[model samples]
Target: MAKHCTIIQGGMGVGVSNWKLAQTVSKAGQLGVVSGTALDQILARRLQDGDQGGHMRRALEAFPFPVMAERILKTYFVSGGKPAGTPYKTIPLLAKDNPRELAELCIASNFAEVFLAREGHCNAVGINYLEKIQAALLPCIYGAMLAGVEYILMGAGIPLKIPGVLDLFAEHRRAEYGMHVVGALEGDNTTMHFNPADFTECKLGSLTRPKFLAIVSSNTLATTMVKKASGRVDGLIIEMRTAGGHNAPPRGKLQLTDAGEPIYGERDDIDIAKLRELGIPFWLAGGYGHPEKLREALSLGATGVQVGTAFEFASESGLREDYKRDLLQKVISGTAHVFTDPLASPTGFPFKVAQLEGTYSEPELYAARPRICNLGFLREAYRTSEGDIGYRCPAEPTTVYASKGGNAEDVVGRKCICNGLLANVGFPQVLNGQRVELGIVTAGDDLVSIAQFLPPGQSYYSALDVIAALEKGCSVLST
Candidate 1:
């Protein structure tokens, strides 16, 4: 079960793979994921910023569903910390009929971040997500399988019903999920249910399915996720186009490179022997984070390597330590750059971008911030010429996304990336004069090879020192 570890840390999302960088890469055995995306609005803004070192009250006192962690700590804690310029309150919009305390704070904030990154680790602990955030996939996979999460992953899209929603929480039932919606029509009502007995109040302990993977980038999306997944995917993370946050774009029409970014030639080459004839287990994300690119992705066959700009500049990543000390001093002075940007992600994919100055990839700091969509997690539920189902955001306010049908030139320069990736992890959104904004950080293009996961002079390193220098070899493939 130790899956030949080379490293799989790459789950950097809104809170940049928190829970102390997935418990220091699952206590060094390697695979530590945990970025269940907007983890219930980053666990309700870390319990309205008061649950500080109590660490979401110690992962909601190890939630095994204790009344959904006492009803999400009696509705998002907030006992002390909300004053400093006042903002953490917004938890409402997640429709398709959500409520019941936002589905128990999306299953106790994805079961307290996969129960504190599988606490004191027994090793295996994965949880990523972002199949275009389909209405928080069944209370975030029933809160990361009620904290036992042993690998789910998922990509930016084409997550063909997430292995039947992990076989309906390993059979404790009620899963539903279909909501992509955009135009709606053939009898409408786009699905979206979830009933592990309507949020488990008692007899429910079943969940053990996990193992899904699917973060593909080609070889035809890894042979269409092993011939159209709906139940058992269990592999593939391919990811290239120099991976970091979101990337897979360039195949035909879109070209860019004069530093605008995208342009991936050789027809975006990815055939690795047709992905080794699609026989399950795979891994190998862009610029494959170190150690001779994890032995050149295990001599071209690969079942290892998923790093994210070297565990997103490690020191237990949830980023923002002055943006990891100014991007690790521009990656130890080689001057960090990163840009895959294709209009910086409103799920328009192609998004690496990190030439940071005041952030938002600096076009004068993204034209001095302003466009404000108040964190509607990549909104796009469409269909409202009166037929209802609203939610817009192509980074919002191009006249409220052209009054909801969107397409004012498809939202120019997009960038809301959920409140700038929760203001690149120091939880931004403060508005109305006290300022704040500044986020734009995304990673890969080997961001100056993360100074080879720093150590020579030790600038800072952790996710178990970048998975122990990529399991003891190092130079991640000369960028």
Candidate 2:
């Protein structure tokens, strides 16, 4: 067994970096992470799809509360899967006032994902969540802790309160997170709370607090997390704007090129020397997927490099085969196109989008889809005029968003990413009984270089191919 490793497999969301992919990397002595975002939707859809080979049921059997597991199985599992062209049954969206059943689904679904990823190996496994998705944070962390998740890495916002939540959950104590509200005044009591005792009657022991790594973009954010986090700060992952999914906006006035991507300047550069002085282990993400880039990161005082694009196309990754084949062919043909869409994400963070013909990146497909917000994870809470909390998503209908205090300008270019990402992994919702959801694939700028992992004639690659390529001649790679 290796004491220290050099790769932190990127935790791509909505089932892209799933159990099969995580298990492969962890078993090889690296930090394999499953996307903890949207597991509630992933779990229910898996059950409705017949769980295809009983994988979900097998993991649920290991859940500490068999009663809870049985309840979830009974409610969502379909024997032969739903009829084609029929939509998945929607569960209630998560909110501070989530129904007891809805909250349980979040917990059980998160637990099942981590439990399944941790099986068939003794190595450590981690789960990744966005700090912005606060409604389900408490129960989701508790569920992951129940499966002994070894690390919790978060980004997409300042996660100053996460380490403390981990501390409380380890002791089986109740935990609360102050939900971010847009128009709340001082003394506002907007918060979401959870307790393990509410779910299980079995006696429990204190769980080990997993290491916390705050994913950040600048030295300032890194220093802020180190000096201001609620509990111990374990490490950091410095991801640049080139990484897939949501990227931290560049500092200062938001300027864009004539082509429309956000311009990154010297202010965007993180001072490596200053960061190394913090004496905390860090990893470099965004375009650092090559062998030389990996070596360069290690030489710069990093623990390793977090690679997403390479592993995202691996055999074990959860991306549908058609999308993989389509993208890989583009990579090989030198025509793979990725655009950094500044306004597509409702979080106000720039989202990386891979341009594909039928995906949501297409103007036609993006325009044709109705503006409906079924999944509300990205919706923000605001204080209404009556001092009551109200929720709205910029991606939702324009009239509805305006009625809830959202500016009409914010609605432009916004897409329903929650549903779009799930569709990328083969569980796209069937809408209107006549149309199937279109996928919106996200990859790092290194999407073109993924061709290196494949053979000269081969079209696809496996997880080991990427690990071997990055670890070639590097002593940190396991033999």
TM-scores for every predicted model = 0.33, 0.97
TM-score of 2: 0.97
Candidate 2 weakest lDDT stretch, 10 residues = 470-479
C-alpha lDDT score of every prediction, in listed order: 0.79, 0.89
Regions more than 4 Å wrong, model 2: 1-4, 476-479
Candidate with top TM-score is: 2
TM-score of model 1 vs. true structure: 0.33
| Top candidate, metric lDDT | 2
Cα lDDT of model 2 by residue, 243-334, tens digit: 99988888889999998999999888989999999988899999988888988898888988998989999989999999999999898899
Over the stretch 272-376, how does candidate 1's per-residue lDDT look in tens digits? 887888777788888877777788787787877798877877877888888888888977787888877888787787888888787778877766777878767
User: After superposition on all CA atoms, how large is the RMSD of candidate 1?
Assistant: 22.2
